[model samples]
Target: MIRLPSPAGRRQFGVAVAGVLAFLGQPVPLTAQGFCFHPGPIARCSWFSVTEAGVALSVPSDEDPNLTFQAGALANVGPRSAVGGVLVGAVFQNDVRLGVRARYRRWLTDRLTLDVAPGILLYNGTFTADSPGFTGELALGYADWLGMTAQLDVVPFEFGTET
Candidate 1:
């Protein structure tokens, strides 16, 4: 049986998620660029270019103490936002999770960006939520190449084991 985390843990998770969302939701300027090159005398710049398109991998944990690996693809939807889907699996357990998320990125400076993602968990292994509980993530991106993220997921209802 999969046991949920303690009440304190849950509260902490909620607070963290709320904070991240609030921070990201603040009014910020859109400063992302379409191209990363300089146009020559005869070249014209495209107004809209796909800024980022890549796969991301992470090992995220919660108060439950289970280490899980999450892999997903991210595509740029706006200047500072991305949307993607992720598959999460426990490293030492048999549970699998799937989710879809939308991320908002805020540039802190020239090389640092604060990222916030909010989404829904479609599947949570044996224990599935009835009302479609939510998930949130906060990340720090550096130099457009490296990132670190913390995630919180809540699945309130369970629907037994999956065969």
Candidate 2:
């Protein structure tokens, strides 16, 4: 059995979320107009995921697949266009990285859209390599079903010059 909030409780929770969203410079849905990067044209906070596959420039002690958990905000930059960024953390492995990314979303209709984003990334890991590495990625994604999106990126890292 699942416990659900009462109507009054739900209202208060919604109001609190609205205030936090406002501080993030995002629009409060069904209330005011500021900036929104919703699922389609109507819906806020779509659940999404991003996957990345790439080879490290420097070979490590143990070569394994790289993966992380992704979540963050997507904002509309213009008509038929929006920008979104995500933070991904590791769950299993000896390393974790925090990535800041941006994407361009183009809407074909109110329910469907396409997007591409290229952004810089910073990596931190527990390997013999450098502490932080500079990187960039490009992704193509599809947005549907009330702002939900799935994305894949081909990321490549450019190791800094050895001093």
Candidate 1, 88-156: lDDT as tens digits: 434224565654555555546556777677775555666654444567878786776666766677766
User: Each candidate's TM vs. the true structure?
Assistant: 0.47, 0.45
What lDDT is obtained when candidate 1 is compared to the true structure? 0.49
In model 2, the runs with Cα more than 4 Å from the true position are: 1-38, 42-63, 90-93, 109-112, 127-132, 143-163
Candidate 1 runs further than 4 Å off = 1-92, 158-163
User: Which 10-residue window in model 1 sums to the lowest lDDT?
Assistant: 39-48
Report the C-alpha displacement of residue 17, candidate 2, in angstroms: 19
* lDDT score at residue 117, model 1, on the 0-100 scale: 71
What lDDT score is found at residue 17 in candidate 1?
51
Over the stretch 43-124, how does candidate 2's per-residue lDDT look in tens digits?
A: 3433223343333322343646555554555555445555555544443255565444554556666556665544333444
Candidate 1: Cα lDDT at 27? 37
RMSD of each: 11.0, 12.3
